[model samples]
Target: MHIVVVGLSHHTAPVEVRERLAFAPTAMEKPLHQMLALPAIAEALIVSTCNRVELYAASKEPDTAVATLRRFLADYHGVPLEEIEQNLYDYQGEEAIRHLFRVSSSLDSMIIGEPQILGQIKTAYGYAVEFRTAGLILNRFLHKAFSVAKRVRTETGIASSAVSVSFAAVELARKIFDRLDDKGVMIIGAGEMCELAARHFVSNGVTRVLVTNRTFERAEKLAAEFQGRAVPFEQFTDHLASVDIVLTSTGAPTFILGHRQMEEILRRRKNRPMFLIDIAVPRDVDPKVNNLDNVYLYDVDDLQGVVQANLKERQKEAHRAEAIVNEEIGQFHVWLANLEVKPTIVALRRRFEEITAQEVAKTFGNHKDLTDAQRKGIEAMANAIVNKLLHRPIALLKRTQNETGGEDYVDTVRELFDLPAPAVDETPLEPLDDDTDNR
Candidate 1:
């Protein structure tokens, strides 16, 4: 089965289109199972993040799998198939593998080199593994992707600057406060982005955290996880004055924290500096709050600007990382191509050995007076002769099979030697032991 990737990302589609296709964490299981159930799909994994919704699958017919996935996405999202098709991008075979590697490494992220994508990929992979939808190919591919991501992060400067909006908020906070250990951080909503920002703060030594949500129970749960205090939605304004860093990410259709409310909090805080980050789509914090003195209010757009600047710097390092990926891709291709001729090489060797053994046995039957050790030595010599005669041709075939457009050469060798085609097995091969060295 060949690997195929079908999806749209921030680079190819706007947020509106991406959001329409997004799979909520709780809602992912059904669609993932459905995709895996497709006849053409041998294995599947779904990576659904805020900016991208991609399906990576091992399938016999990649085009058919792509159509099936596209239909499934359109039907699940209640979007017109035509509309979804226009924004979708498809990659197959080597390109698909490269795309997955790039995405896991954060090279394809909306904010390049942001570390969140790697976690998201791991989460998706874990889900697929739990659901038993990802088989050997996907498992190996994702594991390699994870390793490549770690390598890129360590070897490149792509992750040096914070790029995501949530992390950017933390970066800005560090710039304002000499130390975050004494700061009080208030998360206005129990959303994913808000949770990420809260985690960033907790990791960076923020002392006190206050989680307020529309639903008090959800707020309490989120707060408990972080060992923070939970406050009701009504008390958000009351707690604002105590917070040094306020991050708001609510799905409210209207503004939850307006200028008037923030101005009152500013007065109560005695003109102390405040950092407000609004990461919501509709913007929970009012845009007018930026006009307040000593108030450093940033919205999604502003955070995106910071991310954009970091992306530019990351692009420079990305070129270097891309060179490494390209080299690895070529190596992987060579390995894959050589795999196609391995069976033929094995069969050819077996054929020569069988002929040698048959002749040795017949010759030995007439020489009954010969000692057992002498017979064994003669058999070994015959085996060695067969190996020596076949060695050059076998090595030449393997080398030529690794070249570009080498499949034709492989097929020619197979046809000339009357070698049977190799069977495809998902199971890994066992390592050779010392006893098997004679072969």
Candidate 2:
């Protein structure tokens, strides 16, 4: 048996192509069932995220399976194979296992070390379990993949830092304040980055949100979205004392917030520390405002620097994560190798036992004068001889299954002994944990 994966990702395909191949979580059962129906595929799972779409399968004929998966993708989405063939990539054996490990560990993400892809993969696995598409190999493979991801997360700093500007602002805010639930945030403008930062702050437990824009209607709209109140543009300074965090992003060419304004605001708040994020390109907050006591100001450059530094840290941690993946791949490959050899070993032993039984029966029938003791002696001697004769070959098979040309040895053994083909394994798919996200 062989494991294979065929699909396209952000590295090989643009967003338009990815979108075309994407699968909806609610509708996975049909395609999974269809793929399982194909002769070339024995087990299957589909992982569809915004950045990637992949079909992972276990098969006896790997080359045929890869072609089947690629065609399945094109046919399912009603796209011609030629249009998407260039964007597809396929891997088999250890390479396929390596790809899955890297993806589950977030090392293959467009933004390395992001955590969402892992959860998305878990959800896909959940669908496979629910639909009974993933059998023995995939059940174990996916669980192992999850454990490898967990190890990477625990042993490395890949997910320890924020890699985006908006998230960096929130990270700095988190460091300054012990808790964000009680802190109030104010947005001075309606720039996209400012809105994104505001959303990040709210998701991270900021309870209060104050939005101010040149247009009162825009402020009111944004404030309502956050479940907070809107402050008029001209009167936003008056409300600064009520907020602990401030994010400013406006198209104005000059500084809208100066040192004098922050000094008075600090006094009104009894000199409490405040986090000011100035993400506007031309600088909305005056550079001199950073000199005020108990006030922390991070302009665009400052936040960008923080993001760059954090990205580098994540990159360093990613190398460690790759090592973890490689170690796991080796272990999983051994398990797969054993899986491939198990049936052959069983069949070889059975073949020897059957031949011995037939010969022993013929001898007893022909003699017709054997005593019970004599028959027992003959049976024991026959079993011992069979075992002795088979030991070396079975030993060789087990010892060599994990090495190069292992499958060839299995084939040669089967041919020499004239053993029947190994039976297809249809073990029931095991259910994934309900809390896959936590792991």
Candidate 3:
């Protein structure tokens, strides 16, 4: 059996399509059960995130399995097939394995090397395990993928930078302050962009959120939402003396606070370092404020530019990450190929021994005068012959374990020797935890 992946991703579909296709995390148990119930799918797992949704499966007949999954995706999501057919990208065999490794390693994310994808995949796999939809191949494949991702993180600096606007703000905040717990944030507007930044700060343990808007009622509403205090718009400038961080995105066309006003405010606070993030399109704080001492100002463009630069850095680091993935893929592939090698060899030896036993019985019947010592010598000779004949093929199988067409070569030998097919064990192929299995 081979691994297969049938689904869509950020590279193949837009957000509109992805949202319609995603399997909600809270409601995935039934979907996983439905997927595993399909005859073509031997094992199944679903990974759904904001930017992508993928279905990883294992089957003996890859083509049939992929088709079956595609049908399932459409029917289950209640989406029209024609609308999503062109957005799908499927891979089988080694390519499918490589795809999963890349995804788990975060190389396939919209923001390359984002740390969230690994956790997302892990969560999905956890659900699959909980539902018992994943067994053997898929569990092994995902575990190896996690190991590869861990190696990549240790070996490369792919995720060492911030690549999103909100996260970039958080990084800058860290650089400005020794610790966030002591800092206070004053949000100047109720825009979604500023709210995200505020949330990031609050999540980082900035407990004080002083919200102010033109309308006190709106300011009070937003402040209550974050469980903080609200200040009147006229009184915000006075409270500026108490805040260390200022986040603003308002409808004002001109600068609300000039350098002169900031200088007076800084003097009252003994010139304590202040961070200003003006996310407004028309620019909230005056550009001259950047020239003031101990004041750091970052506008929307500045934050986005930093995010873009970090993205480029991530892209460069992604090349190194991909190399790591390729190396891991080779090792994992060899392990998979060798999974059936020992079993096949055991079966072949058993088959030869059975044939030899039958021949020996017939020979003894024909030559009734043969002694017991002669019978023992004949059995030992048969065993020696079988061992010598099997040595070269077994050696070749081990040597080509990581090479192309290794499984096919093993299959040809099995058929040529008329060996029985290996029994299927749905239990996870145990990981390399044992002393002997470590190889």
Candidate 4:
């Protein structure tokens, strides 16, 4: 089976289309299992994030896999197939490998060099593993991709810069407060983004954290994980005045914190410096809060500037990372090309050994005086001659087939020798704990 990736991302589709196609974390399991159930698909993984919804699968026929995935996506999103078809991009074989490597390396992200994509990819891979959907091909490809990403992060300077929105929020807060360790951080919601922001703060040694959510249990649960205190939803505004940093990310479908409430909090603080990071999609903090004295309110768009600056710095290191990926892609292509020749090589070797065995038996029958050691020597010599004769031609054929599209040469080899079709074992592949798989 060959690797095929069919999907739309920020590069091909806008956020509106992407959101429509997005598979929520809870919703992914059923669709993933359904995709795996398709006869053509041998393995599959779905990477669904805010900006992209992609399906990476190994299938016997790429065309059939793409068609099935398109239909599945349309049905899941309740949108017409044609609508998504227009924006979808298909990458097969080597191109698919390169695409996955680039994604894991963060080069394909909206904000280049952002570290979150790696985590997202790992999460997707983990889900596929849990669902028992990923097979040997996908497991190998993804593990290699992860290794490439880790190398890029360590060997290059790409990760040194803060490029992700969450880290950018922390950077903006640092600009306002000068020190994060002494800051009091009040997280306004219990969403994933907010949780990430809180974790960033906690990692940076923030002194105090107060989490508040519409659901008190969720707030308490999240807060307790980080050794922070949870406050009642009604007390969010009151506690807002005491904190040096306020981060809000909620799904209220409306503005939860208005200008008037923020104005009162700002007044209570008595012109103390405060950093307000509003990461919510619908905008939790009022836009007018930026006008208030001693209050620095940064929204999603503001974070984009920081990410942009970080991207510019990372662009220099990206060339190095791209070179690594290209080298890896070349190596993978060589392996793939060899994969197409493996069955022919095996069959030809088997054929030669069979012929050698038959001829040896006939000769031995006539030479009854021959010793056992002599007979064994003759058999070994025959097998060695067969291997030495076939090695050069097999290597040349593989090279010619991969380079010149010489299907006729491979076909001739198969037809003349009566070789069997290539067989791919469908056993589930294990994940690598170290770099042993790479070797």
Instruction: Tell me the number of clashing residue pairs for each predicted model.
Output: 0, 0, 0, 0
Candidate-wise lDDT, in order: 0.82, 0.90, 0.87, 0.83
lDDT (tens digit, per residue) of candidate 2 on 151-199? 9988999988998899899999988999999999999989889899899
Give the top-scoring candidate (TM-score): 2
Question: In candidate 3, residue 23 scores what lDDT?
Answer: 95
Stretches of candidate 3 off by over 4 Å are 14-41, 46-53, 61-86, 114-120, 123-133, 153-160, 213-235, 250-253, 268-270, 424-439
Q: Give the TM-score of candidate 3.
A: 0.83
Error of 1 at 417 (Å): 4.6
Residues 1-439 of candidate 1 have per-residue lDDT tens digits of: 4689999998899999999999888867788898898879989899999989999998768789888888887888899989878899999878987898899788998667777888888889879988899986687677777777777878999788776778887888888888999999998887788898889899889979999989999999998988999998997889889989988888899998888888899899998999988888888887888899989889888988987887788999998778767766676666556556676788788778778989999989888899989999999899889889988888887778767556666667777777766664565633311211100
| Candidate 2 error regions (>4 Å) | 20-30, 71-83, 190-192, 208-242, 250-253, 263-272, 292-294, 421-431, 434-439
Between candidates 3 and 4, the one scoring higher on TM-score is 3
TM-score of each: 0.59, 0.85, 0.83, 0.62
lDDT of 2 at 47: 97
Better of 2 and 3 by TM-score: 2
Q: What is candidate 3's lDDT per residue for 174-235, written digit by digit as tens? A: 98898998889999978999999999899888998999999999999999988989998887
Candidate closest to the true structure, highest lDDT: 2
Supply the global lDDT for candidate 3. 0.87
TM-score of candidate 2 to 2 decimals? 0.85
